[model samples]
Target chain A: MQPGISKKRRAYILLMRILMWLSVALTAGLVLFLVTYVMAKGLPEISWNLLTTKPSYLSGNIGILPDILNTVYIIIAALIFVIPLGAGAAVYLNEYARNKKLVAVIEYAAETLSGIPSIIYGLVGMLFFCSFLDMQTSLLAGALTLVIMNLPTVLRTTQESLKTVPQSYREGAFGLGAGKWRVIRTVVLPGCVDGIITGCILSVGRILGESAALLFTAGFAHAVHGFFEGLNSAGATLTVALYVYAKEQGEFGVAFAIAAILMVLTLLIQLAAMLVGRYFKKRRDL
Target chain B: MCLPMKKRQSKIDPVTGGSDIRPPVLWDSLMKKQAFENFIYGVFLLLGLITVGCVLLITVYLIISGIPAIREIGLFKFLFGKTWASTAKTPQFGILPFILTSIYGTAGAIALGVPIGFLTAVYLAKAAPPKVKAVVSAAVSVLAGIPSVVYGLVGMLVLVPGIRSIFHVPDGASLLAAIVVLAVMILPSIVNVSITALEAVPQEYEDASLALGATPTETYFRVSVPAARSGIAAAVVLGVGRAIGEAMAVMMVSGNVANMPSLFQSVRFLTTAVASEMSYSSGLQRQALFSIALVLYLFILLINAALNFFLKRSKEA
Candidate 1:
């Protein structure tokens, strides 16, 4: 609007804004671009044999079936512990407690817990939880360790969702002479179903993608048979596999294939969570 | 029959707008009421105890189990040493160089990520059309949900080679490449927190600022930012915590070498140092790795403490 605010100055301001946004877009693009380029280069090396077969000493062209199996096993096992434990904790925090001091402490604990570096969790997983349980890098120990790593996140998300339910609904239920348990089950739980699902989906992303705690407790095994045996066994995950392949794989082709697999898996997870969440929300609306 | 009826009548009368009543002997007993109340109270106490117990046990566990390596390495040398060869004859555990590398890398990332994240958050919160805001926010969240390992994979493939060619570096996996990737990795946390903070600024403040002859942008920088400074500060610290604590993505493209960080050179960070050598390490060397991990954890803890302190100060102010 001013006379001195000429074309050059306006142009400079516009350019700066564009550059600022370009960086954000570029930052987000870095991973996708990398994965696409490498996977395109190396997908040929990936085969059914590479996926289904076990590792071999003689050649670099081995399979990751066991590692993949281990990753799934630990994640499922982790969810088992995380869901019940974390959801229960969230329930307690949201439904029962009335004291502000107690609530503050729980909130502080969550922030601090999330801040602790994962490597320390790995060490503790190795030292106490795994050793004491006699689980030794087995799915049981890995799951237990990850349960600790994930509980805070799971609890926080669940608690936020649970809190979103209307208090009036709760009061109405109570006025009907329903017991406390019945009120929570019939009114509160049903109302927050979507939020809970969102939390669980987000948490699954964490458990599947995590590497540090698994580093010590879920020592890589590549067996896909007999659920217990495979679970108890140690091997690799998509993450650990990518790490191992990138560092130790003699051929760039193999390494790139593994990296591509990780990228696709992660993108699928993000997409699935969003789509599933939206689908459920749309259904509820209808 | 007559006595039972009379007792029931008395109990009902006392509870429902009746005179103080006497119940029959068995019905009037105090034991049942005490037991029920005690059980209810006990359940509440147990839940409280569990929360307290968990926080206490984990903190104590981290400190007790994670300190031995620090003890062995000695403070100055472990923190300030340059060599990080876990398999070497002497097995030097000087993680100082790695620590500094982490610092610089984290610094670079925060510098690039925070501003854009803040502005984008503000746009999403205050400026953008609602539909566009929703899409952008979801995109940001998707970026957040994408695993760190996946980010690492991308860096290794696209960013590395792209940087190598663009900057004319020998390797694509250099400090600059790592910085760009990490900046992306941190965007979600920064944006999400900052948006919440910006949205928290009361609308009336903006209206009032506009009445004083300030432009929208001026009001935003001076009024909104300062008013939400505490939240922004908390957001920044939280990002730092994530950046420093992050391991998988940094390890993938940081070139995992223990040396001073040159902008174009490959460097290892404290996180990458532990992760790369962890699978093969043993003895004092492994302990030293644990020490480095402890240092990383300590840095994060310090950030958290600072966040709480700043939040308190801001609240008081």
Candidate 2:
């Protein structure tokens, strides 16, 4: 640290710093390398027929149509059941609640829930939503489980974002003699649109990537005729499909295809979220 | 978005600027205000009640479903027993090996994960130029976003085969693969938390350390690691919890074996066993699989509670 320090001492210090950071860099690199290699090796054998067709273990036709159908159904069911509920919860937390202590507790609980492993949610799903509710291995069960799982993260995130709507904007509306509901509808909600979308996209990404909880509660379905009518449906997500294919022999190629799909979906979600965030920032500037 | 800088003057403020303020519709305004307050209170109350109900419903169901299985297996054997198989008549539920695998797997992941994660965070925070920080942080989140299943597949293709070739193992899947992949999977969490923790250490700590003749590198390790231990520990706990509960990826590479973890041998964790066989399982077996999940749930709840406690205490300190 001293200006008068010996050159040898300085050299030794530099060496120590380099070594410390180098080890860390090497580890990260190795991890990334591992992931990238597996993906590349597995990518070659994928074909469109594999996805459009249905899986036939006996016939050797490795199709993913059912898995795709199930994934779509899960998303739709989640949207139908959870969007209104989550939005309602956020509205109450953001606009109605006055007790700071209660607010803090909710916030803390929600944050904890967000950090929890998805598999725990799966366990809870199988128990409460699937068995206790008599909605076993059905789309209803999976959707309900997702509602609970996605609630804390989404509601808290939405509440936080909604709360960020400028108080002055609401006051301005009020000063103009607008009703409370009208002010909230016209100003506060719009202001929080970008933030809510951010939360939605983040949660969506989590949902797409989620496998652990979905495995048991959703059950595995190869195919479905319709998305809406399949209430007592069992299905697999792309992530789950990848898990299924990766484990068994001869389906290694199919596994990589699923992984690629998941990765691309994730990237698209991230890109959209970034775009939304950037748009908000740009709009605010205007 | 911005909060109200100042509370707006309500209609009841009778004397603004010392002028006589008269409101003929005072009762109407007051009633409206009261109603609005009531509505908000009602909503928050409902939400609070629902949140608690959600927590209770899950916890209670886990207990209800798992207890019968535990009673049948006998609680001691369910927790400490090594043989975990279930049938109609004689259901053997031994969770000891899974417990060891989870604990040991998590420990190994931490050992491999923390150092690398902490260093990358340091590099990203301190050494990496500011312009690069933005892209790097996003990349880290991308790492976080990558599904564990994908990581498992990645392990299968890359880690598994690489280990086989490098170490001359019989097959690709092994404990070695889990250790490597889980460590990597948890790296971003570690780095993100560590950077935050390290950044939180007051600038004065560095200045004071420098004044005492310690270089930045020396100060970073000697002083920074201790100061940021709480946050770092929180990160580690989160990472370990993640590793312990991780199923799909671990299941893929773990060979799904229940034996003790040799460096090259693959092992199924409690989560893996549950997830692996849940599709075909029924009756006591299904219940037992859920019981494994229940055990993990309890661990998560406990770990989270402990984490919140530590974070609170750290903030207070």
Candidate 3:
């Protein structure tokens, strides 16, 4: 307590400190409430039947197996297309580009792409992939739209890891008569494997959570199909299914079940990201 | 073997050495290798340009599709018109309600979210012990990772009902509920970015404040916060962008009706307006939806530019 300080100022500071602690407590409490509430409401409804079979109108049964498979298919498809383009862009920007202005423009474009809303992506995706390209609201069009949306995420992560590769390593490889591309393939590419993996996990989490960007691009169909077949046909992932069930069909039970599954997956992704970060840190130290 | 062959070749060259008179086969092979490397470099360059191409494509598509409706509706009526009756006989295309709802919704979310987020960020970054910080931060990340639709679901189940019961409103899906959901939705970005900014404040500034007889809280608020103003501004701006752009969660809770925004009344946001009607809309109505999206896109672009400006200033400072 300073001799010159007033009691009112002391009260003000006390109030702020209390409010800060309260806000932090509120945040933690909200998270706990959401997870527990969704799981408690949803877990009992999830069954082997729900996990394995598609919905049938004749039986009046509702299942999310198709949605789950659709999610997996879209994730796989988007990652397949996104990784090469994203990592290649990152490599070029970090390793090959000499012009500062061009690099800045590319980076700015990536930033702009990321900031655009998912609904906007859905619209443009609907126009370009569905109408113009005549893909017509298939999972493939949805996945392609996500390719553009997640490109910045993958590019950023790969660029960060590429930056961590030592210049000395590149010099050593070149000293051994390796060409530039050979040096990149042997040294730089290997070093960024963790980043690419991390990016994949992050993008998967995003794809799992996405709904607005998929609704128009991937129409809501419940049929389960093979990978190529699914890509060419209309389908709904879990998020979209959740929206459809809760908002359109009034099936809170099915929506809650999907929400619970997504919550668990979200937790897993967060944990994996933390572990991967730690592993990379420890490796760098060693 | 390569050294002996090179030596033999050099001796046989008699008048000129290998450097002056390389074999045509070797020269051709080297030229091909150089060309191949150049081709690979060109491939990578093209890959980099793909991102730029995507941006161009999005911009061009939005503008081309977005212009016709504006041209037909007249920019004034489309932008400032109060009614949004798209399906009625002699349909009206006013989007003032949507625009105002978005503004109010985003403002309301920011008002509610920023204070709590800023305070929580201060506690986490400066006051909390490492273990507590880790746990709380993890909790925040989980909150963030939960999808927007999940937020909408939870809001529909809990917050919507809760508001209905508490306020005795006929339908709890109103601008207030949307604001509440958006506030919670933007919390993670606000907290995470603010924590980074607050932590980046130089330690000596706080230490000096403490040495000058200021309390820790006082030092943080008076000294640390002022130093991190630009970053905090950026965080707020990021929250604004998120709250405005959010569609699914808002659509789920906001009752999806075009109305002049009153806190307790059902209203449509700019995002929900575009999303709700895009599926069934036809002809000029569909074009109007594109025009709505164009407006939203422009808003986002402006926000992005502001974010970049703040981020750059923070880095320089």
Compare the candidates by DockQ and give the number of the best one: 3
Question: Please, what are the lDDT tens digits per residue for candidate 1 over residues B177-254?
Answer: 788888887888888887877788889999999797655655666688788888888888888888888887887788
> Which ten-residue region of model 1 chain A has the weakest summed lDDT?
A26-35
Where does the lowest 10-residue lDDT sum fall in candidate 3 chain B? B1-10
- Report per-candidate DockQ: 0.33, 0.42, 0.60
Q: Fnat of candidate 3, please? A: 0.75
Candidate 3 lDDT, A1-286, residue by residue in tens: 6677789879988998999999999999999999999999999988899999899999999989999999999999999999999999999999888789999999999999989999999999999999999999899999999999999999999999999999999999988978778888999999998889889889988998999999999989999899999999999999999999999999999899999999999999999999998998899899
Model 1 chain B: which ten-residue window has the lowest total lDDT? B1-10
Chain A, model 1: TM = 0.88
lDDT of 2 by residue, B134-226 (tens): 766777777888888888777776678899999998986888788888898888888898888778888888889989987877777777778
Error of 1 at A15 (Å): 6.0
Instruction: Show model 2 residue runs off by greater than 4 Å.
Output: A1-3, A6-12, A27-35, A56-59, A174-180, B1-44, B85-91, B168-172, B207-214, B313-317
lDDT of 1 at A38: 57
For every candidate in turn, the CA RMSD to the true structure comes to: 5.6, 4.7, 4.5
lDDT of each: 0.72, 0.75, 0.93
Residue pairs with colliding backbones in model 2 are: A66-A222, A221-A235
- lDDT string, candidate 2, A205-262, tens digits: 8878888888878876776558666658777778778777767554777888887777
Error of 2 at B64 (Å): 1.4
